[model samples]
Target: MNRRTFIESMGILGAASLLPISCLHMQPTTNYKLGYQLFSIRDEMTKDPIGTLKLLKKLGYQDFEIYGFDAEKGMYYGYTAADFKMILDDLGLTVSSGHYGFSGFLNAPEDILIRFVDQCIQGADTLNSAYITWPWIAPEQRTLDNFKIMSKKLNIIGEQVKAAGLGFAYHNHGYEFDDHNGQNGYDIILSETDAALVKLQMDMYWVMHSSKYTPKELIQKQPGRYVMWHIKDMDTKTRDYTELGNGSIDYTTLLPDPIASGLEYYYIEQGGNFAQNSIQSATDSATYFKEHLQKYL
Candidate 1:
């Protein structure tokens, strides 16, 4: 069955009874707490890291996942990890995790792995996060052999990270699902990697966009491997992202087995939102989750 039908036809044990209360409750409740990806506030942060963080605190966010940090300036935009962490802590927010790219994974000299691990350790220390995530792969490096190479490297990285009292995970963009010689890269990674070391941070919107499979099916297929998610909704008609709950991704239904999808932390992201103000966009998404996702609890 197609995704829409697959999700629709599948019965939730308490869906009907749950819906009315979830949809009708006007008091503003929270089922699942939410997080913001620092990248979403890149512009404002680039201009003012401390200021932007203060704004986020004002927005009522309690957790964060960073994507970039400018060491020289001591910030994600210009503050150091410690400085940023202080802001988050002052607001009673935690920095759950952050995304690093593939460069560290494919280091030049083999011994560089030690230095790489140290760098990740330092970053994790500053933020007090237990995870350092690899969030992307070079588009051209999409191949079975490349994936296998990455899997091996990631296993090593994961081991190193674990030793440092932190965890390691790979985040997906849509490209990972593209068929490479009849095999999906994500499937390859899952099948071949060390479960104890490497984990998956599935980006639900991208996974849905890629047409590889349904989010629920993948979660069911590999329970507990997904430890986090990048949550956003898709405009079914436009085949693009929309604010959460304002679009068609039925998060309510998905919540019954959220942990099954390996979800421990969920961050809100929108790759594009041309019309709305960026902060407003994120605010709307968070508000939707606070309202609609409450039923899942």
Candidate 2:
């Protein structure tokens, strides 16, 4: 989905309960949540969330990062939070996090932001999601000034999320790396936000595609602040998102220390440019991830 449709909607479990495998002295991979961003197969999800989830489970996915939240209705896809949780529970699946429509309220009043955040909390509480993520900022709101302003809002939302025993995170896109003199929007977000309150969700594709910093370099900027990741590959020729391993990113060697990243959960995502179709792309990526990357993660 594009930014508008993504925003048109929009934490949970605490950090302590989600100790990273790397931090656990190379504990079994089963102890960690291997997830996929539903946006990668959004069409199938919209058509049949249950069946699509079942397919993902069969493909070895155990956790999910949800999207297309209807905040006004407190619904995901078309089911209420309670109903959706029941479905996941029945399937032996879990939601590690959610991508909510937070950018829409970037400039709204405190009351408005609070009201919306409370609504988000309700759904996340029901689903037991680990983090509620602010995925994107509209193009017009990407200015350096807005980046500073957005960081303040992140702290505000992060406070509420923490208060409710949930975590709050921000997911980055390529645009965040856009340079203004020597600094960029990401520099402001990393510096201005309260690390205790707010966390970072690194989209590796974006870091590889644009940022002057590599994934490891970015993680070094804030050791334990990065709690989640969106792993995808870029088309070698066009540099667009593609099925994992079908493109140029060699995650086998590219991954940083999960312990240092303070990582808990990660989602495999493909925004578009699927090799054949969305579900096929998801299946293919899952296969590659399980065979080549899940061990590293």
lDDT of 2 by residue, 34-127 (tens): 7899999999998999999999998888999998899999999899999999999999999989999998999999999999999999999999
Give the lDDT of residue 108 in candidate 1. Answer: 48
Against the unseen true structure, what C-alpha lDDT does each candidate score? 0.74, 0.89
Q: What is candidate 1's lDDT per residue for 130-166, written digit by digit as tens? A: 6888887776677778878888888988888898888
| Candidate 1 segments whose C-alpha is farther than 4 A from its true place | 1-32, 70-75, 104-107
RMSD of each: 7.5, 11.8
TM-score of 1: 0.83
TM-score against native, each model: 0.83, 0.90
Model 2 worst lDDT window (10 residues): 8-17
Residue clash pairs of candidate 2: none
Q: Which 10 successive residues of model 1 have the least lDDT summed?
A: 21-30
